[model samples]
Target: MTTAWMNATIYTGEDFAEAILTEDGRIKQVGSAEDILSSSPDRVVDLNGRFVLPGFNDSHLHLRHLGKQLQSLSLSGTKSIQELIVRSRQYLKDHPDRSRVALTGSGWNQDQFSEKRFPTKEELDQISSEIPVALTRVCGHVAVVNSRALEVLGLDASTPNPPGGIVEKKHGELTGLLKETALDYLGPLYPELTSEDLRSQFQAAFSAAVELGVTSAQSNDLSGSNTQALAIWNLLLDMDQKGQIPLRLTQQLALDTFEELDAFFEEAKQPPSDHLSMGPIKLYKDGSLGARTALMQKDYADCPGERGTDALSDESIRKVLSWAQENDRGVIIHVIGDGALERVLNLYEETEDPSRHGLVHCQISTKAQLERIKEIGCYVLAQPIFFDYDLKVLVDRVGDELAATSYAFGTLMRKGVSVSLGTDCPVEGVNPLPNLYCAIARTDLEGKPDGGFHPEHAMTLSEAIRAYTAESAFQEGHADNKGKLAPGYLADFVVLQHDPFQEKPDALLRNRVVMTVIGEKIVYTHHGERSTTR
Candidate 1:
């Protein structure tokens, strides 16, 4: 297939061009529209002076979870515990069949609530004393459950807290809050989905990705249960073979044991296809800032003597890194707090090849840590969109000194660190436009703080775009072949209504993606006219 996209302002990262020509699923040439038209091979697309850039690459997110969230009840914007209970009750009332199964929902933030605290078991028990209820916080690190859920999990005052997790209690009574490792136990309690259900979930996620101009994603299947994980993987592989998957997926398998890892490697001996590939082993070092569960160097400013939980011990982290080095597999760990970052970095230093590992959610870091990240040369999968909510409570959680350096995108780039952008979807939406706006504006959704929250750390338009594209491609080991629009690169790009560089930061959020092309095929087209031929 040969196609020419003309009358477009193409941002190739290094240079701007007027047209791009593709042949056999790769960019054949980039030049003036007249020059591209002179070739006149097969088809032509008049972009009507639209802005064309490389398709977005969300470096880290949970694909299947995003799909499930799309179907589940959302408590994202609930203003109080009363509202949460009301919504949950209504949802239960609407779906009577869910009464038998554990009620699962997410996206509630304590900061957003009027009471400024987590909901208690008593409040949730009002929804249903018979059925188990588990409501996850927006950060995905903590969850609040009802009394029945605790009983179902066999948790009580006599039950000791697991390592690297917390089962919150006050006055010798359970508060229904589960942090870090506590969430691991609740996985088995939730209802299991069938193979057909898994396929439907993935299909919904892939369709959303393409519609949002996301050409590639690095997904972590942290759904628990090795059996279900492998089943979902097989379903994705099947979809890719049948050309049903629209975007490229490089999976970060969540295998906790060496046995599972060995089995996965044995089955994945062959090279990956264009649409599906196995990338790295996924691990968690700590939790999120919102839940106050991220391991920090010191106590939280607002909550004294409370340094957050560390999901893995230093020895465990070292062992995992060593195993990855020995097996020649890369590991991507979720490290949020400065303390967790330090410990994970220390383990990386001990590893034979530090570059073989990547870090996710490098949210809270110091200048020294940023330097170390640059020196280590590991990929940093960051989510700029987090600022929308994290900025609201940053100073209160980490104090002024640490808050200034939080979400330091520009500083990392200046230190020569490879930083990529992601949404961690279900925590935040997978729309790259708002993410780009956050990276540049460094402000909340309403555009607060006058200029920006630490505007000094805000990235330029081009820099943010690069992080979402080339840097993400680098993390997926497709740097040379996929991220740019030059010759020899994959024909994956998005056409937008306005040039991002020429627009204000706020305007970016409102800008729409007109068309999305992957492998030289138009996967999604919202509003565009084109001429085509065989």
Candidate 2:
């Protein structure tokens, strides 16, 4: 089938074009509308001078968690502890059935609260003492549980803190706060959903992606045991084979042990469909900055003597990387602190190929580290939207010297390191526009800082777009076939109402995705009148 998308303002990275022709799900031609129309294509789409660019590709996120968050109790924008309690009560009142199950909620930040403190077990006990309650902070690295949850998990003041994790306590009493690996204990308490239930959740998540013009994603659904993880992977593959999902998926397997890695490799040896493919193994080198759990070179400015935590020891990381190198598999690690970045980089230099392994959330780094990243030729997966919240607390956590170097996308790009942008959804929402805006503006949604936070480190609009598109595709080994508008490239692109390059940084926050096309099919359209094919 031949389709001509005409009279469009196409940003082809290197240049602009008036039209593009697609045949059999690949771009066949690019030129002026008149030139394309002379061929008398089977179908013609008039974009009416709308903006067209390669579809957004989120390099890293948790798809299943995003879907689960959509249905669960969310304290995402709760401003105070009282508001959080009120919302939790209201959710339980609305969904009386969830009372029996472990009540799970996410997106509460202590920094956002008026008291600037994590909600305690006592605060949550007011809502329910019978039901086990666990609410995750926005960073996903910390969680606060009620007394009931602590009892359910068998955690007490006598219980020792697990390696690479924290169980907060005051004096001799447990405070019901868990950090890093400590949160893993809550896994068994979650009720398992049936395959049919999973299908519904996956469908909801996939629909959400396309609606935001996200044609592709690299997702890590890391919950559950090895058997369950494999099942989830197979289920997603089945969905792709059955055409139940439209967005292209690159699954980042979360293998905790060598045994699980071997098992995953055995199952993933088979070739995947065009829309689905197995990606790198996912690992966490350190925790998140929000909870002060990220391993850092120096102590947090506000809290003396605290350098955060490392999820994996140097020996463990070396072992995992050695295994990956020997097996010819790539790895994507979650590294947030400068200390973690330093350690992981040293390991990458010694045992593995940095190009094949990516650093996720390289949020805190020095100029030296940035130089090393470029020299090592590894990909940096960043969530620019993190600035919306991190900007509020970064200076206090780390001194201004470190804070200035944090989230340095422009510096990374200038240093020749490939940087890709993602929202790390459920941490921040899965909206690409806001992320793009953050990259360009270096400010929160409200547009803080007169110029922008260290505007010197800000990326140009074009650079930001490339990070969200071509650079993201590169991370998944799809740059050759996707992420661009050249001939032979997949016909995956998005149509927008405003030209991103022409609009001011703040204006992009309101920019709407008018239409989304993947593999020559219109998967999402914001309004009927905005899209038409003849």
Candidate 3:
């Protein structure tokens, strides 16, 4: 099926072009308006002078989490413990059928609280002691649950904290908060939903993604420990092949044990499909900044004595790296603090050059670490959404001194490092436009700080585009097909209302997706618009 899109300006992402024609999911030719129509044998579109660029690809996202969060009560924007309780109570009142409440949300700033504290078990218990409530922090690295939820899971102060996770306590009693590994304590009580339930959530997430010009995304598996996540991913893949999957997904399985890694590598010999593929092997080196557990060299500006927690031992990382290097599998490590960054950098330098492994949240890095990262040729899948969400928290965690260097996208790129942008969805909201806007404007979502945090590190408009598109593909090892608009590439692209380059960076954030086409098929179009395929 040949669909000609002419009379428009196309930023081929490689060259600024006049127009292009797409036939059978590949760019037929890129030329002027008159040239593209001469041989057209199918439908044609009058661009009416709009911008056409490669579709957005979120290199790091959590599709399952996105689906699950859609159904869970969201408390993302709550500012205080009181605000969180109020929201939870309201959700409970609204959804009277939900026996066990999992109030998961993302926007709380531990430093911003007037009490300067995390939500306590006592606080959650007061809201509804009978009903269980588990509220996650903005970072998704920790959560606070009521006593009832803990009781349902048979967890108490005596329950040992799992490796890489912690259970918060005060005065030698459980505080009703779990971090990293200890989070498993709340499981079993919240019964696992059926695959049908999960499918509905995934469909909701897929719909939300396609509407925003995301034809494809990667599920950066951080929460799942075993092959259980991969099982779900494989199911999604089969669905995609049958044309039943709503959106394309790349599964980046998080490694919990060497045995799991071995099993995945054995299964990695298969070819990738239009729907699903094994993406990367994710590793967690440290915790998150919001929880004040991001292994840092210096103590947090607000919380002293705690540099951060290290999730993995050096020996373990080396063993994993040895296996991945030998098998040629991609790696994605979560590193937020400088120490965490330095640790991973050392491992990367020791293994291979330009390893192409991803640093999930390379939030803080020093010149030496950046230089090493450049030398090794690793990629940074940085989340600009955190710019607005974590600026204050960052400043508090690392103090103004180190916070100034956090989320250094432009600086890293100028220094010859490959940097890609992502939402880290469910942790950061699942929107690419807002992140693209932040990349250029470097401003917070609320347009705060007047000039944005460390404005010097802000990326240019073109640079931001590449970071969102090409750079992300490069990080995922799919640059040949995913990032650019060119021949032999997936005919996945988004038609926007205006040329984002012509408008102020902040304005792009407010822009909406007009059309999203995947594999040359119009999967999503603005309501009331004529179908391109019809």
- Error at 192, model 1, angstroms: 1.6
Regions more than 4 Å wrong, model 1: 222-225, 268-272, 527-534
TM-score of each: 0.96, 0.98, 0.94
Better TM-score candidate (2, 3): 2
Backbone clashes under 3 angstroms, per model: 0, 0, 6
lDDT per residue, candidate 3, 213-256, as tens digits? 88778886433545566556555755666676655677787875
Write the residue-wise lDDT of candidate 2 on 241-260 in tens digits. 79987988888878767777
Q: Tell me the TM-score of model 2.
A: 0.98
RMSD of each: 1.8, 1.3, 2.3
Please give, for residues 58-140, the per-residue lDDT of candidate 1 as tens digits.
Answer: 99998888888777778888999999999999999897775558888998999999999999999999998998999999888
Q: Tell me the lDDT of model 1 at 309.
A: 80
Rank the candidate models, highest TM-score first: 2, 1, 3
Which pairs of residues collide in model 2? none
Alpha carbon lDDT at 280, candidate 2:
87
- By TM-score, is 1 or 3 better? 1
